[model samples]
Target: MERAFVVLGAIFGVAGTAAAAAASHITGAGSGLDTAANFLLFHAPALIGIALLVKTGTVHANIGRFGGLLVLVGVALFSGQLALRALADASLFPMAAPAGGTTLMIGWLLVGLAALVGPRRV
Candidate 1:
């Protein structure tokens, strides 16, 4: 699980940097790319933290894992759709970004809930 999170974090980190560069250099690139990059950059660390917290038993493991899953799915849906649209001028069905955004918000809330649920080191 820890390894999975670490790998995901690394992937997101690299992809975010590339997205940012694309947004800056690519002609006719829209804000969707920028938004996707920001989301990926922001959630990458949070996913890593969740992995650490779960591994250390500092939080409810199940909750943390679920939250981490949500983060991954949210990033894929939200950022994925945006990047697709920005680069290919197409979308991955309707309302994908909004759904992803909502999922991300819920995922973050779950992480907070895990922190509140106990066994925390701090």
Candidate 2:
């Protein structure tokens, strides 16, 4: 689990850095790719790392587990949906992005809940 978190953190760090660089290369206001990629490539990894911390039994607590899962799902939807929309220029459901945003908010709330629950002792 610790290894997994490490891998996820590394992946996010690289992707986020690359995306930030790519965003700078764009001349205009924005393509939205950078914004979308930032969330996916950066936050996704951070959240995954948090989940890894929880899963490794370091933060063993039901709230933490639930929060981790929520954040993971939220990141997946938030980032994945945006990437799909931008890269494919497809939007079957107009409400997709909004839904993703909502999921992200909920994920943050879950994390808060976990913090309230506090960490379990090893």
Candidate 3:
């Protein structure tokens, strides 16, 4: 599990770094790369945590597991929405971004609560 998290973390870290670099080349100062990078960085550790969950066959708590899932979904939607807006020049649903952001916060909170609840013991 630990090793899995490490790999996941590395993947997210690389992606975040790449996005940040691309942001520099985006020309427009407000290109959403920074937003994407920051969120990816934020979720890097969560990826590790997810790996840990996989290894242990469990999580600190069910809530944490659910939270991690939510976080992943939230990041995807939030970042994807911005990218869509940038590439398509249309928002489709501008509100989706904020909704995703809200899910991220809730997911983080659930993870924290899971930590407080402690991991399951076999």
The numbered model that scores best in TM-score is 1
lDDT by residue (1-122, candidate 2, tens digit) is 43554465566667656656655674212666577667767575666667665665555356665655555556556655665565576663667667777776776676667666667765
**TM-scores, each model vs. reference:** 0.91, 0.66, 0.73
Ranking by TM-score: 1, 3, 2
The local lDDT score (0 to 100) that residue 25 gets in candidate 1 is: 85
Clash counts for the predictions, in order: 0, 0, 1
> Per-model C-alpha lDDT, please?
0.86, 0.61, 0.72
Best-to-worst ranking by lDDT:
1, 3, 2
Q: What is the lDDT of residue 79 in candidate 1?
A: 96
- For residue 99, model 1's alpha carbon misses the true position, in angstroms, by 0.8
Residue-wise lDDT of candidate 1 within 1-122, one digit each (tens)? 77798799889999999998998888235668988998889888878888999898888888888888888888979999999989898999899999998998888888788878956444
Model 3, runs deviating above 4 Å? 1-11, 53-59
Candidate 3: 10-residue stretch with minimal lDDT: 1-10
Return whichever of 1 and 2 wins on TM-score.
1
What are the clashing pairs of model 2?
Answer: none
Count of backbone collisions in candidate 2: 0
Could you tell me the lDDT of residue 101 within candidate 2? 74
